[model samples]
Structures are given as structure tokens and as C-alpha cells.
Target chain A: MLAKRIIPCLDIKDGRTVKGVNFEGLRDAGDPVELARRYAKEGADELVFLDITATKEKRKTLVKLVEKIALELDIPFTVGGGIGSVEEIADLLHAGADKVSLNSAIVRNPDLINEASRQFGSQCIVAAVDAKSQGDQWEVFISGGSKNTGKNALKWIKEVEERGAGEILLTSMDRDGTKSGFDLELLSAVNDITSIPVIASGGAGTSQHCIDAIKKAKADAVLAASIFHFQEIEIHDLKEKLKNADIPVRETI
Target chain B: MIAIINYEAGNLASVSNALQRLTIPHTITNKESELDKADGIIFPGVGHATPAMASLRENGLDSWLKQTTKPVLGICLGMQLFYESSEEGDSEGLGVIPGRLKKFDSSQHKVPHMGWNTFSDVNAHPLVKGFGTEEYFYYVHSYYAPENEFTTASCHYINEFSSVVCRDNYMGVQFHPEKSGKEGSLLLQNFIQIVSSE
Candidate 1:
């Protein structure tokens, strides 16, 4: 049986791990390499490092950090943020990242998804869709959720799958950092429309929220930041709760 | 030393990094001469079988892999390439193992079968010495080799599939041990032990 994955997303800026509440106020968490090692030890199924700095000048530091993290971390990890070209994606993968997540770059040039997937294989290309509720529908937001693309979230998800993205990291801008819970309705809607694996992100306050994301929305994985970063919820204890809820989670001991 | 076969298969770095962390001596090489100097070979791959096979043949690794007497372990697409053929691009394999690879029925289950899944029926083999049914390994693939005579261990998703396949001198795992955490590291360590024993 495929266990439901529990991921700890480390938002990286200036090579340090930081968590933003609603993508605005940045709070220092800890060192990325140290946190990554701790999370792996705590039984995180996978790790995602989003380089929030994502500047052309900062690309070198991100690559170096990725190489360092890959040296210490054993589980599969993803590196994203300002990954525009196939060359950048190649550099990250070559640096030992198991996968690379693309956001604004892919939205601007959707063909990059096709070309990157074709060149690196879809297994390594992840399409991260950040969305927020507008009226009755969810609209895609890019550039760290600062700009709304006005694209229907559901339709864009289907397009991304068709473009050969192996996985979709669907984050709810409305739920991110709120710690209330994941946007279940949005997640389920995206889940229904796409066949590729959907990773539910944002609004993870408690273990029940994680369970709801998995059981209610049918998310293959759940990614949270502050909860794990602050020790508010220990991954092992959360997996215990998830296991008690009959959700298949990897062993955490 | 373990020589990781580098046929332009996308994931040589992670495998080499894993071995380096384990403090195991290894090298990534496409040359037959380098492979000849190693005691074991790790064939790491992640991509479509067609292009992977094309690269293998282009580098003349298909014949070398077929004739190599040293212990060989293939990961993911590398394992799929050990079979007779794959439905993915209708590509032919090295034929070290019988049968062909089939795509999972997406109508019934997820296409890629990603994430941690446990394997059962783990026959007593050196490569899987301490692995049990409860252990989980990281997997990400669309095509799977069905359970067959060469299957040493199997996993179930939509259907029972060969997760670990082995025969004399050759072993293949559909999961990425290099990225499977502690248990994954243990599997690599076990492989090195097997190489040492041989």
C-alpha cells in the first residue's frame, strides 16, 4: 500500500530557513541544513526547499545550499523558486536534488514545463500552483502570491498534467500560514480534475488538518512549515495520530 | 570499489552522494575499462525506458551489462531495463530478466505509484537480508515488472508487482534506495556487503 506522505517544507531565503505567515511577514526558523537533518531524523517522508530569495545573483548560493543539503539528507527532496530555464533545473538536479519545483517561470512560459519534463523526465519536474479563492472560484497566483494570473486553478492543473508535470504541489494562498486547515474544497476540486499526484500545502494547524487533507481531499501528500519548524507538532507524534486515524504513514521512530 | 554505471540516466549524483555518505568507495563511469576495475556495479536510472535504453546502447553498455559477471543492482528505470521489454516507448531491454514491463492501470490506481510502499514475500536474499514486509522504500515510476520467477520481493498497489528482482549476479529494485532514508542506506550498505562477500 502507498503510504500517505508527510512533508516538511523549508522556505529558504539567504540560505537560511524562514517561514512566512501568508507569504509576507518572514520569521527566521533555523539553519536549513540543521533543520533538514532534524526533519529526516523525525521521519519526514520527503523535504521541499523553496528558495524564496530566488534571485539571479542568489542562484549560486541556492545551488551550493542544495549540494550541502543533499550531502546530509537521504530522503527525496525538492528545490524550487525562480527556476526559469531547463539549465537551472539541470543544475539543481545535478546538485543532488531529487526533484525541482517550478512556479512563476512555468506560468509565464508553459512550454518550459514540457521541455523540462521531456529533458529531465517528468518524475523530476513538479508544477507548484499557488491559488486563492476569488468570489466562488479559485484563481492562480504567482510571484509569491503577489500577482493573480486570473487563470482558473482547476484548468491550469489539468494543463500542467498534460504538459508532463509528474506531480502538482497545490498550495492554497488563502490557507497558507493561517494554521486553520488546508483548503479542502480547492484541494478536492484539483484532485478530481488531475490524475498526477497532488500534494496539499498550507493551512496545516493540527494533525486533524493533516488527516482531513488526506482522507477528505484525497491528497497523496501534505506539506507544512511552521508547525514542524516551531516544534508545535512533532512529526513522529503526528504520524502516530495519522496512523491511529487509519491513514497509512511511514514508520516514525 | 563499486562502479556506478553512468549512461546519461539523470540520477547518478544522488546515488554517488549516498555511497559517499556511507563512506563506500565508488565511481561514476561510462567507460568499460573503469567498470572492469570495480568489484560491483550500481546501475542508477530515472527516465523513460526508451531513451534510457538508447543511451545504454549508444555507450555500448547494453552488451557489457548483459555479459558482466560482477554483481549488478539496477534502480528504478535501471531495473525496468533489465527485462525483455517495456511498454514505455515499446523499448527493448537488456534481457537479463525475462518478461516485459507494463504500465499500471491508471483507471484503478495512480499512474506513477509514487511515495513509500512496503514490499512482501521478500525471499531470503543477501540484497534484501534485513528487509521485511513492514519496511518502506521510496518509489516513483509508471511502469512495473509483474511478479515472476526472478522476483525476490513484491509490492502491491493496484496489483502485485515485482519491487525487487534478482538472479545470479544481477539484482534490480523498482525503488530508489539512495533516497529511501535509513532503510534505503541500509539496503545500499547490504549491497556493499554482498560485493565484499563475493
Candidate 2:
């Protein structure tokens, strides 16, 4: 059986990890390399580096940062934000990212997913879906959740899979950064429709919430940024709590 | 020194960086001469088997990989290429290891077995000796090679399948030790030690 994954997302800006992560042993969180090493030390199953604002000039710096982090950390890491073409995705993969997540670009050109999966592999492509609840349904949002695409969430989920996406990173815009809890209803509905692995994102406040994301939402993985960034929850402690809750997690030293 | 065969498949950086972290001298090469000089070979790959095999054939690595006798380790798609053939791209493998690759039935479990999974029915080998029998390692692949006489370790996902396989001088593992964490680092350390000893 595959163990559930607990991922800590690092929001990067101009080649630096924003929202500092401080502890006794770890260095400054401003350095992505140091933060990556620290997260690996704390037994993080995987890490996601999202370049919050990826500009044309800052792309090289971000790639260099990714290479540095990859050199020191042994765990699998993903790179997202401003991933537009297959050529760019190939370049990042060679630079040391195990996978690349696509958002707005994929929404505009769905064939990019198929082309990339053929050029690289489905396992290397992660389709990030940012959705907000609207009445009885959930609407898909893009452009870093700033613009509503006016597309149905469930329909888009199936389209990505059929277009050759390996995994879906479902983020709830309404609950993001709130730390209230995961959107269980949305996650469950998405998981029910698609057979692919769904990573539940948004609103992870406590360790119990992570458990609920797995047990209740049936998410294969739970991804959080703010909770992990503020040092409210340590990866090791969270893994321990999840293990005790009957959820099989990777054994961290 | 270990040589990571670069046949145009992605993920070579991760494998090379893992070796560097262990302080083991290694090179990422597609040249037959460099591969010939290296003590051990690590065939790293991702993506489909057809294009991967084509890349190997284009660079003349297909024949070279089959003829080499030094200890060689294959990861993910690399492991799949060791078999007689794979159903992923309907391409023929190196025939170095005696087996055929099969795709997992999504009806049984998830298509790609992504994330960490533990080992069962592990045999004593230098590469896996330092780790526990049940220690979990990260895996990300859709097609898998079935168990046979060369299977060194087995793991259960949708069904019981061979996760680690070794045939004489060639060894293969479905999981990516480079991405597996502390236990994974130890496993790579063990591989380096095995190569250095040889």
C-alpha cells in the first residue's frame, strides 16, 4: 500500500522563500536552499516550490534556486508558477524538479497537457485547480485565484485527466490561508468523479485537519502553505499524529 | 566512479546530485567510452519506453548497456527497459533481465502508484542491507515488471509485484532512492559502497 503524503509548500518570490520558517537548528527561511534542507530533515514527504510572481527576468534566478535546493535535498520537489510551454517544463525538469505544476497555461491550451505528457511524462505534469464555491456548485478560478474562469470544477477535473494529467492539486480559494479546515465536500466530490490522485489544498490548520483531509476527503495527499510556513505544525509531529490516527505515513527518522 | 547513463530521459540531475551528496565521484554521460571507464552504471529515466528506447538506440546505448558486465542499477523506466519488453510503448527492452513489463489495472488501484511504499519479501543485498525490511521508499510509475527468478524484492500495491530485481551483474529498482529521504540516502550509499568494493 502507498502511504499518504504530507507536503509543505514554499511560496517563493524573487528566488527566496517567503513566509519565514524558523527553528533552533534551521537557518533563515529567506534562503530556499536552507528551507529545503530543513524540510527534508523534518521528514517532509515532498515539497512544492511556487514562485508566487515569476517574471521574465526572474525565471533564471528561480531555476538557479531550484538547482541549489535539489543539490542538498534528497526528497522529491515540484516547481510551479509561470510554467507555460513544454520547452520551459523540460528545462526545469533538467534543472532538477521532479515535476512541474501547470495552472493558467493549461487552462488556455489544454493540448499542452497532452503534448507535455508525450514529451516528458504524465507523472511529471501536475494540474493545479483553484476553485471557489458558488451556491451549490464550485467554480474553477485561475491566474493565481484572482480571475474566475467561469468553468465548472468537476468538468475541468475530468478534462485534465483525459488530457493526460497524472495528479490534481485542488485548492479552495474561499478557505485558503484561513486555517479553518479543508473543504471536505469539494474534495470528496472531486475524488468521487476522478480515479486519479487528488491532493487536497487550502485550509489546513491542525494535524487533525490533515487527518480529515485524508480520511474524510479521501485525498491521497494534503498540501498546506501557511500552516507549515508559520511553523505552527512541524512535519515530523504531523506525521506522528497522522500515524496514530491510523493513516499510514512515511516513517521519518 | 559511477556513470549515470543519460539517454535523453529526464531526472538525471536528481540521480547525479544524490551521488554528489554521498561524496561519491560520478559522471553523467552518454558516451560509451566514459561508461566503459566507470566502475558502475546507473541507468536513470522517466517517460515512455518507446521514446526512451529510441534515445538509447540513437546514442548506441542499447547494445552497450546490454553488453556491460559491471554492476548496473536501473531506476523506474530504467528498470522497465531491462525486461524483454514493456506494454507502455510496445517497445522491446534490453533483455538483460528475464521478464516482461505489465501495466497496472486502474480498476484495481490508482494508475500511477505515486508516493511511498514499503518492501516485502526482501532478499539480502548490499544495496538494501542497511535499510529495514519494511522501510518505505518513494515510487512514481505506471507500468511494472512482473516477479521472476531475478526479483530481489517485492512490494504490494494493486497486486504483489517485483519492486527490486537483480540478475547476475544487473540490478533494477522501481523506486527512486534519490527522492526517498534519509533511508533512501542510505540505500544510495550502499550502492556506492557496492560499486567501490567491486
Candidate 3:
């Protein structure tokens, strides 16, 4: 059986990693490459480098940073934020990113997903969706959970999968930084609708939270920030807990 | 110099970068003349099988690659292309390894077997030198070649599929050693050391 992945996401800004509460009020974590190497050694399944700085200056910095990380780290990594075109994705991939994640760009132009999957292969394109619950529905949010798209979460996921998005990274804005756990209902809703691998993000505060997301939400992978970045929980320990829960994990050295 | 046969496949950068990290000198080219100067060849590809084989034939790399006696390694699609044929486009392969690549029946498991999977104990080979039997390597492929006499390592995806195959100077891995973290880099390092010693 395929192992459930435990991923630590580093929100990079201007070549430095920044972590905030609920995606706001950023604080410095450490050098992106150094932090990535540490996590890789600590038994993280993968690393996600999200370039929170949307400016052109920061984008170039992120590309260079990714190159640096690739040189040092031996684990799989993903680069996202401000990736708008095929050429940009190509640049990131060429810089040593295993996958290029599309969020805002895909919302503005869904066709980019099809074009990117065609040019780069669907396995490398991950569609990241930020969702917040509104009454009885989970609505898709864009621009790092700042704007509502008025689109149904499940509907958009199916559309993106049809558009050739290889995987879906669903983050719950409501649960993010709450330290409560994942939004199980929202995760289940999206997981029920798509066949592509789903990476559950946001609101992971403990090892049990990760286990719950996989067993209850039925997610293929789990991603966290504060828990990992703040060292509240080490990746190896969390993976051990998940292993005890019968969730498959890569054996640690 | 080592040659990485380039035909517009995914993860070329990672492969080249891995080689660079190990400080191994290499070149990426499709030109036959440059390929001939190389002591070893690495055929790396990530895409559908039919067109990948077509691209090789279109570029006339098929004939050029067949004549190479130097150590040759194929990763993912590169491995599939070494087979006699593939069900992807019902396309014929390089026939360097005697087998047929077929699609994984989704009914049994899943298609496009992705992520990391473990490799069984490997016989004493230069490529498997530093790596252990239980070491996991990254893999992403829709079609896989059935295990045959050439299989050097096996991985069970629904059922056992050929993970690594070796015959004479030729080698093939359905998994992507370039992208597969430490174990993967060590494998590449072993390949470089083998080539350098030769």
C-alpha cells in the first residue's frame, strides 16, 4: 500500500521563510534552504515552498532559493505562489522543483491547467484550493484566502481535475492556525468527489490531527506549517504516531 | 563524460542536478556524434510511451542508442522504451530488454502508480552497491514492464512489477532515481562511481 505523506510547508518571502497566524502577521522562521535541509533530515516526506511575496523581486528570489534548496536537500519539494504561465512553471521546474503548484493563476485562467498539464505532464501540476465554510457550503477562496470565488469547492475541484490538475492541495481557511484539527467535513466532501491525490492542509496542530485527517477525512497526504515550523511537533515523531495508527509512512533512518 | 539522452521529458534538470551534486561530469544531448564520445549513457524520460518512442525514432536516437556498448541506464519512460513494446500507444520499444510494457489495471489497484515504493534485495551490482534492500525510491508511471530474466529488483504495485532490470551493459529502472531523495542520489552516485571506475 502507498504510504500517507507528511509534508512541512515553508512559506518563503524574500528568500526567508515567514510563518503567520491564520496567514497574517508574518514572522521569520529561518533560511529557506537550511530549514528545508533540516526537515529533510528529520524525515519529512516532502517540503512545500510557498513564495508568499507576490512581487516580481520576491518571485526571482524564490526561484533562486529553490535552486539553492535543490542543491542541498534530497527530498521532494514543491514551489508555488505567483506562478502564472507555462514559462514560469518551466523556470521553477528547471530550478529543481519536483512540482509547480497553481492557485490564483488557475482561478483566473482555468485553461492554464490544461496547457500546463499538456506541456509538463499532469503529475507535476498541483491545483491548490483555499476553502472556507459559508453556512451549508464550502466556498473556494483565492489570493491566499483573501477573496471569495463564489464557486463551490467540490465543483471547482472536479473542474480542475478534468482540466488536468494532477493533485489537489485543499487548505481550510477556517481551520488554519486554529490548532483544532483539520476540517474533516470539508475534507471528506472534497475527497469524495475527486479521484486525484488530495493533500490536506491547514489546522494540523498535533500528530493525532494528521492521523485523524487520513483516517477520517480519507486524505492521501497531510500538510502543516505552524506545527512543523514552530517545532511544536517534529516530523519524525508525528510520522511515528501516524504509523502506530496504521497509516503507512516511509521508514525513517 | 556521461551522456543523458534528452528527448523533451520531465525531470531532466533533477537528473543533471543530481549528477552535478556528485561532481560528476556529464552532458545532455540527442546528437549521435556527441553521444558516441560518452563513456556511459543515461536515457531519462517522463511522458506517454508511444510518443516518447516516436520522438526517439524521429530523432534517430533509436539506432544510435542500440549501438552503444558503454553502460546505459533508462529511468521511467526510458526504462519502458527499452522494452519490446508498450500498450500506451501500442508502440514498439527499443527491445534492448525482452518484455512488454502494459497499463496497470485500475480495477486491481490504481493507474499511474506514483510516489515512493520500496525495492527488494538487489544482487551485487555496481548500481545497487551503496543502497540497501529495503530502500525506497520515487516512482511515477502509468504502464510497467512485467518482471523477466533481466529484472534486478522488484516492487509490488497490486502485483510485482519490474523495478530494476539489468542485462549486459544495459540497465533500466521503472522508478526515477533522480527525484527519489537520498536513496535516489546514492543510486546515481553509485552509477557515477561505476562509470568512473570503468
Candidate 4:
């Protein structure tokens, strides 16, 4: 059986871990490699390092950080943020990242998804979609949830899968950083339309929220930041709760 | 030293990085001379089957892989390539194992069978000496080699398939041991022990 994955998404800026509320008001978290090692020790199935840095030497710093984390962390990790070209994707994979997530890059040039998946294999390409609820439907937001792309979230999800994206990292902009719970309706809607694995992101406040995402929405994985980062919820205990709920998860060996 | 056969299949950095953490010396090479010099061969790959076989033949590693008696460990697509053929590209394999790779029926189950899955119905072998059915390994592939005479352990997704297979000196695992965390590292250590014993 394929266990439901629990992921800790780390927002990296200038080579350090940071977290922002609703994609603004960033604050220092901790050292990325150190935090990553701790998460792996506590049983995080995978880790996502979203580079929120905005420097000219950003890629260089991210590559260095990825190499450092890969050297220390045993589990798989992904690098994303401002990854525009196939060459940049190649550089990150060469630096030891097991996969790379694309957001604005793919939205700007949708062909990049096809090209990258064709070149590096779809299993390594993740399409991260930040969706915000409008009056009746959800709209796709890019540039870290600041700009709305005027694209329907469901349609974009279909397009990415058709374009060969192996996975979908779906974030709810409406519920991000609120810590209430995951947007189950949105998650279920996306899961209903796509065959590829959908990773539920944003609005993760408690272990119940994680369970709801998996049990209710049928998410293949759940990703949270502040809850795991601040020690509010230990991954070990969360896995126990998930198991108690009859959700299959990988035990920390 | 372990030589990771490099036929431009995919990234070899994670494999070499894992070995480095284990303090095992390895080299990524496409040359037959370098592979012949190594104590063990680590065959790693990712991507489609047709082009992969083409690249292997282009570099003449196919014949070398078919004949080499040295302990060889194949991971993911590398393992799939050890069979007689695969439905992925309608291409032929190295014919080292008596089976063909088949794509998971997506109508009933999700394609790619991604994430942590465990193997059970184990047969005692050095590569899986300590591994149990409770132990899980990272997997990300669409095609799989069904359970056969060469299967050492089996995992259930859409159906029972050879998650780990061994024949003589050649061993292949459908999971990425390097990316599977503690169990992954332990599996790699087991392979290191096999190579060291040789």
C-alpha cells in the first residue's frame, strides 16, 4: 500500500528558512539544513524548499543550500521558486534535489511544463498552483499568490496533468496562514478532476485538519509550514493520530 | 569502489551523495573500462524505456551489463531495464531476467504508483536481510515487473508485483533506496555490505 505522505514545506529566503502570512510579512524561522534534518528525524515523508529569496545570486544560494541539505538529509526534498528555464531545473537536480516544483514559470510559459517533464521525466516535475476563491469559482494566482492569472483552477489543473506534471501542489490562498483547517471543498474538487496525486497545502492548524485532507478530500499528501515549524504539532505525534484515524502513514523507522 | 553506470538516464548525484554519506567511494561513469575496474556496479536510471535502451546501446553498456558477473544493483528504471521487454516504449530489455515490464492499469489504479510502499512475501537474501513487510521504501514509477521466479519480495499496489528481484549476481529494486530515509540508507548499507563481501 502507498502510505499517505506528510510533508513540511520550508520557505527559503537568502538561504534561511522563513514563513510569511498570506504571502506577506515574512519572519525568520531557522537554518534550513538544521530544520530539515530535524523534520526527517521526526518522520516527514518529504520536504519542499520554496525559494522566496529575491537576490541576483538567488539561484547560487539555493543550489548551495540544496547541496548542503541533500548531504545531511536522507529523505527526498524539492526546490522551487523562480525556476524559469530547463537549464535551471537541470542545475537543481544536479545539485542533488530529488525534484523541482514550478509555479510562476509554468504559468508564464506553459510549454515549460511539457519541456521539463519531457527532459527530466514527469515524476520529478511538480506543478504548484495557488488558487483563491472568487464569488462562484476559484481563480489561479501566480507570483506567490499576489497576481490572479484569470484562469480557472480546475481547468489549469487539467492542463498541467495533460502537459505531463506528475504531481499537483494545491494551495488555497483564501485559507493560507489562517490555521483554521484545509480547504476541503477546493481539495475535493481538484482531486475529483485530476488523476495525478494532489498535495493539499495551506490552512493546516491541527492534526485533524491533516486527517480531513486525507480522509475527506482524498489528498495524496498534506503540506504544512507554521504548525510543524513552531513545534505546535510534532510529526511523530501527528503520525500517531493519523494512524489512530485509520489513515495509513509511514512509520518512522 | 562502486561505478554508477551513466548513460544519460537521469540524475546520479543523489546516488553518489548517499554513498558519500555512507563514506563509500564511487564514481559516475559511462566508460566500460571504469565500470570494469569497480568492485560493484550501481545501475541507476529514470525516464522512458525506449530512449534509455537506445542510450545504453549507443554507449555499448547494454552488452557489458548483460555479461558482467560482478554484483550489480539496479534501481527504478534500471531494474525495469533488466527484464526481457517493457510495454512503456514497446522496447526490449537486457533479457537478464525472465519477465517483461507492464504498465499499471490506470483505469483501476493511479498511474506512477508514487510514494512509500512496503514489500512482503519475502525470501531470505543478503540485499533484504533485515527488511520486513513493515519497512517502506520510496517509489515513483509507472511500469513494474510482475512477480516471477526471480522475485525476492513483492509489493501490492494494483496487484502483486516484484518490488525486489534478484538473479545470480544481478539485483534490482523498484524503489529509490537513496531517497527513502532511514530504511533507504539501511538498504544502501546492505548493498555496500554485499559489495564489500565480494
- Specify the poorest-scoring 10-residue window by lDDT in model 1 chain B: B103-112
DockQ of each: 0.86, 0.86, 0.52, 0.78
Q: How high is the lDDT of residue B17 in model 3?
A: 80
TM-score: model 2 vs. ground truth:
0.97
Query: Residue by residue across A1-253, what tens digits does model 1's lDDT show?
Result: 7999999998889898776333212232357887788789889999999888856678899989999998888999999988899989988998989999999999999999999888889888999999999998999999999999999999999999999999999999999989999999999898888888999998999999999999999999999988887778989999999999999889958
Model 1 CA deviation exceeding 4 Å by range = A20-29
DockQ of candidate 1 (2 decimals): 0.86
Residue-level lDDT of model 3, residues A1-253, one tens digit each, is: 5677888898888888876423222332367776777788888878898988866687678778888888787778889987999999988988888898999899999999999988778778999999999988989999888899999988999999889888899999999989999999989988878877899998988888889999998988899888877678978888788889988788767
State the lDDT at A235 in candidate 4: 92
Best candidate (score: TM-score) = 2
Q: For residues A104-145, could you state the per-residue lDDT of candidate 2 as single tens digits?
A: 999999999999988889998999999999888899898888
Report interface Cα RMSD per prediction. Answer: 0.8, 0.8, 2.0, 1.0
Displacement of the residue B7 alpha carbon in candidate 1, Å: 1.3
lDDT of 2 by residue, B84-140 (tens): 988876789999987778898888666789999998778888877866556889999
Candidate 2 residue spans exceeding 4 A from truth? none
User: What digit string (tens of lDDT, one per residue) describes model 1 on residues B22-138?
Assistant: 999999899999999999999999988888888989989899999999999999998998999989989899999999899898887667789999996789898999888999999
lDDT string for model 4 (B76-160, tens) is 9999999999998699999999988998887776677889999867899999989889998999998999999999999998989
Candidate 4 stretches with Cα past 4 Å from truth are A20-29
What TM-score does the predicted chain A of each candidate obtain versus native chain A? 0.94, 0.97, 0.94, 0.95
